[model samples]
Target: MNRSENTATSAAPAKITDSGQFKRSLGTWSTLALGVGAMVGFGWVTLVGGWINDAGTLGAASAMLAGGVMMAVVAFVYSEMVAAMPKAGGEHNYILRAMGPRWSFIGSWGITGGYATVVAFEAVALPTALEYVIPLDHLHLWTVSDSDVFLSWALVGAVTAVIITIINIVGVKIAGSFQMFVVLFLFLIGFLQIFGSLNAGEVSMMEPLFSNGWAGFFTVLVVVPFMFVGFDVIPQTAEEVNLPPKKTGRIAFISVIIAAAWYIMIILTVSSALTPEQQANSSLPAADAMATLFSSEFFGNLMVAAGVAGIVTSWNSLQMGASRLMYSLAQGGMLPAWLGKLHPKFGTPVNALLVLGAVATIAPFFGHKALGWIVDAGSPMIVIAYFLVSISFVILRIREPKMNRPLRVGGRGNFGVIVGATAVAITAFLITLYVPGMPAGLSIEPWIIFGVWWLVGAVFFVGIPGGVKPGPNAEEELMEKVYARYPHRRP
Candidate 1:
């Protein structure tokens, strides 16, 4: 196993100075909000009926429960690694430490691809949602995959993308504050839905608890990983947190539990509020459930407002995460160094944020169908990165037995290996779920998306100067050289 880049010191530890570094500002609670906000995206609002219909009520909840357990186990691996490292590039640093630059590129690329998908998905999701709220019947400029791209609808998402991009580039502190406020609103809306369900909705409406047995269960299981992807964003922004390193990691764990419970409760409440026939007939079950149970259009509108909040939370955090991961790759000489440049005053990754912004703004032009397929394609890549991080954790345990861990988990030797092996086993199984011909096999369109993305990633991998190597300071040494090029950079 390769030694970690963090394990380096010839003379009392190097100062590790750099012109572009993030300011530490986030506390544990704010950090938790960020993670929870990302995980609980627009899916619950729009897709709850689909999930329940596919797997039935109890089966869907069971699948989510299993998926949540898998994610929690993966979070344990992340908790240990983040406490020990607490660096900017979450999986990139860990994979580089255990594997090498080549594999690290693969893992980093995987997550970057995933984050980019969510960013783009939210761009179109915003517009599609507003169409529901306002009922846009304008003429579309064109059509793709049977989805229209009307000027008014596209403008909503594009405008949101630009606004979100600017908010991120201004600074992390402002962004973090906004996240906390919106997440609280999201919780309040959630409580409204649950209370309405309890007061007027019928529990007897939740029939056919198990549908098609295991086949139905795995269908919901396949999408659960993507739903839980936001928990790792906590580690991606590890450098900016004000809490102790171990606590930052623990916040990630807590966020996972909260998000998981949030989804299950959403499924249960939606089930109670709508019968199977009503769910099938309704377009947005959660929102309609709100209006139906309470007999007020205002309640449905509030649920739509919650959907907007989900969009903001997911978009804000993912744009931050994607930019930082790109910045990290650039910092390490794996990407163009210019993309790594940070604002001298704001301390945000301006160039990186712009790159994602441009992509997201243009994605609405492609219509919602294509972007939905892109998100599905990117989901597998994210799992690949998670699997690699799990591998890195086990390797680090064996290689750096004495490394300092502020919040160490598992036992020494065999016990630690058991924890890592369990994570690896679970992640690997999730990866297989994406393969073709399986019960949870993805469609051919997503496969084409996967090929195109990896091909682009390969191009950048070929441009790195020193290539892949095995050593303690391989990435550290390479990144310092990149930093050397812009010695006196200013805002």
Candidate 2:
């Protein structure tokens, strides 16, 4: 497509000083760290034992590999769309262009929920990790879902939530730097596990690798997408990335590969270091496995500390991703305009960040029992967004054949269509896993939460004005309608 045609299809290039725009300051390493850090959060530290029990070591690792491949396909679809659009709200922009505003709202809302849930998950997860290192005094608070809510424990997470929110509100650069620093510790923990496994791991400990057979494997497989959910943060912050569009796409894809390798290695290391009996008995298998391999409690504490770092990284990135997504939605008039307002000095989405941060802060009070429900509820939402994005990919390929895609997935012609179609099929199949009878079906609580979230989204969908076409002036048209609805806010 010519420059004129591209301009008509895509948003104008972002400027550093433009009002309500993200500052372009994120470098290659920071960008990669954002994606990697988001994916390699505390899940491995706390949930490894459950995975081992469900599918055994090898079975779990296989499930992770399979899920990673499926995500990689989705990543490719994201890469192509992000390269072509390179806007703030990753899926929102692509779906809006290809499928129009209503679908865009649905896709964007799905991802926003996914990111927001992770933000809350990390808030609870941070305190949980810290408890392994230094036990917090449980000041008796009420119990929810049979889990005690302690004031002291909840305070730790709530305080950290405030700090993370401040870091993000200060600037994307600061948040990216924090993410990079924390991610180094995450890498350190991974290397220690790998080294320990090589030095003292026992192959015999990996016996009965298949566990409960296909049923167990499928259970583990269903959660794989949730584990690798953070890579899409790259596209959400694409406007701030300093690299070329093609390079940005490549980094997003590479992050997925790194995360896949990270998870598989963790499973192997844990399996080799601990017997099945030990794993079953342990609360934190990965940490215990490291401590066992090294023969020191200090190493175990270090693993927990690294897990805390992982929590911070995930919290920071997801908060950033969620806010940008909200900003994008608001900017398009799908949400209230206040969320679109950037911090006058920091150039970050202040309202969006604050709103999400408030949710994160309150999440800790709900205690750890809510974490599972939040996670399960968020998984299908993430897949829903991915499914829509895949559909958008196919739509754009067929409708806008000459649209510029810097990092084209299958290069040109019918092959790109085939790749997109494959992504659509894979995501569609993955979505079915959440059905009530499916092996990976969500529990009752999560099902209720998921239903309520979409029902709320449906209200927003119906409230927005009709006939807002997706193009250069789409935002303006929607904004005008928004102002018409709430004239007092117009300026």
Candidate 3:
């Protein structure tokens, strides 16, 4: 609070030294869609049957319910942090303000990697969905790990990734606009599927709810944080939101509930429509369940079609969110200076967007089935970011108790401690699921993927400019050092 402390900690913000900042164009609806859309990706279509098979129908539902609650607690922390500091880099800014630059980089690094992995997976997933609708693998493009990549399938993913990147580079509004439209369709079909099953769904089909006891429950429970990750997109895109801070926080939490309910309903409807044997044997259980309910294969394929909508929505939003993080880190002099560059005409993170898009464009070469390594790799990264954010929340509460919190979590004097402690406890448990000896231990392949990504992050982590303290002037101070270090660099 003292002048000397201020002077020593950070410098006054310099003039607009970069291309410019993100434009405030995303409204409440678009923002909400971004969150929900990112959460409901193709996971529901491909993984639901496996969830039921592993945990049983009742076990699956219970896992979602319990996992949803844990994620909701983490969302509470994010909502409050976003409300307190409505910035472009959601987790990056929060962690910086609470725990300084090193910790900030770690948390942001983990989450940015998490988001990037999903973007790549969706690239592969889109073509996989197309394969389901129509076998379009005409020209084979070599082979990787027993999976053959066809010219047509590879083209679909690569071209789509490029188009999505261009949309984002043009402006956040356009990307948000596309997200809003597709997510609406996704929701409509999802609602119809659930409603159509009401009269035909059988309760007797849901017997043997808990399979393999607690281990089965843990399998489904651990995957929730990864699936429920979209809610944080609200914060990642906070600066562009054209609503009040409180509303962004409120909509974010609401989106989590919506996504959780959607997943649970899908599980219930599919389980009820088909017998246990049917669930275990069927590759496309959700589509099959819809077909059985409506007595039409048309409706079943329609569900798969809706899942394609989900893939696009999730892919687009994650790119939007992740690029901002890359920009934020570069803006703070962590990564190369140009990665934070905004488009002079569009006010978008041009360089950062392209970097993510380039990698995603190559994902199709591996084929969709082999992309599980990426999804598994990213899940723990996301969980680690959540844990760090919770710790940041508690740190800020104690270090700067007077900081604004437009969406405070708890009540009275004990609020921050209670909420922060609870989030830490839950996320810690979630992290264990991927560790060795756990019920749902991750494979070596995923761990290797995770290691490679973090090593890249560590390069940037160690390169951050010195004396970068957490406060209003953090970015300003960081830029000063960056400009001073590289005199040739320009705004």
Candidate 4:
């Protein structure tokens, strides 16, 4: 192997700095917490029952493990990319460098939609989690999709959204610290459940380990990607991490491993502690399982509180990711340049934060019924971005073989190519799951939402002057045009 080809060139800096750069305040542990906190959100509390029902105990755990493996491959690709070009927009920088501006816009937009939807989902999820602990008075404010919209419930989500947004705007350190504290509590709850399950759970409840055969397994596998989606948040905020590039890359991969273990543990704990009939009767099976295992309702309520903590961690992290992506797009001339501006004091993307924050705050007003649709709609988009990034990984490996990779996957050889190729194949397979008639195909509503989002993206794509052309100078050209469009943003 040529040593010259192994080191990064000056063209790709270890740290990307500009007049409007973000504050590098996130340390190693904080960065890891960002990814882990985002991954271990409220889904486990509400979705564990469905996972058990669809695929039984071992089946669901297997699917989650499989999904983790697939995502781990993808994370390896991200690890190299982020290590090589540690920038604010994770996939944006990778895609742009490999495939140029047009495809970069598509990939960035795909992830932005994915992150935004999750932010909105968490906004609504917060209220839903609260309702489990303290029942809200229904001041009926209309309905959507047959689910009644209530003022009191919606207000809880909306207010939390505002507070979370403020926390982010205050600074990344504040948000990262808050995430670490909340994630610790979540881990404590997880430990309690694991210990309780060991003490009181019966193995008989785990019967029918593979329900409905392949169909059930595929159903669980399709959503596994979504559950493991948060690990990528590390790449989005790569520019703000106060750590070595290689360590940052390692954290991304580690987060995926932690999440895999977390999901598997949750499945085993839930299944062992509750019978099929018990799970069927309970809306929140994980909480019920904790309650049953500990023989106390307080533990169940404590589990619900953990779910709320999950919501906050996820909501805060995704908002940070989505805003940085928007800021990246604007800086690259894919979106309005004004969105690229950073706050002088906080060094955060205030304008972009406000825009996404506003969207999240309004999400609650539409009611919780749209949560499912938002998730399904966002799934394909997230996978699409992953697919494109996988392709970019291969492209960069072949095109810039000597490019510096602080945390190179598979070492400096053809093995890295094999890893990238595997990622491409896996993401391609995941994409097909969303197509109509597939075992894990999305519903018509999500399809419609997916179509509308792309259509909107197309409109923005057309609006760019002269359109973005793929080449060596694509980024520079795009930035030049952006500066021309918004002179005040020129830096």
Candidate 2 per-residue C-alpha lDDT over 53-122 given as tens digits, one digit per residue, 9 for 90 to 100: 8998889999899989988988888888888888898988888877778888999999899899999999
The positional error of residue 221 in candidate 4, measured at the CA in angstroms, is 0.7
Clashing pairs in 1: none
Worst 10 residues of 1 by lDDT: 8-17
Q: Higher lDDT: candidate 2 or 3?
A: 2
TM-score of each: 0.94, 0.95, 0.94, 0.95
Q: Candidate 1 on 273-293: residue-level lDDT in tens? A: 888888888778889889988
Q: Model 1: how far is 171 from its true place, Å? A: 0.5
Q: Give the root-mean-square deviation of each candidate in angstroms.
A: 3.0, 2.2, 2.7, 2.5
The CA lDDT of each predicted structure is 0.84, 0.86, 0.84, 0.86
Model 4 RMSD to the real structure?
A: 2.5
Off by over 4 Å in 4: 1-19, 465-473, 481-489
Tell me the lDDT of candidate 4. 0.86
Shift of residue 325 alpha carbon in model 4, Å: 0.3
Error of 4 at 466 (Å): 5.2
lDDT of 3: 0.84
Which residue pairs in candidate 4 collide?
5-402, 8-404
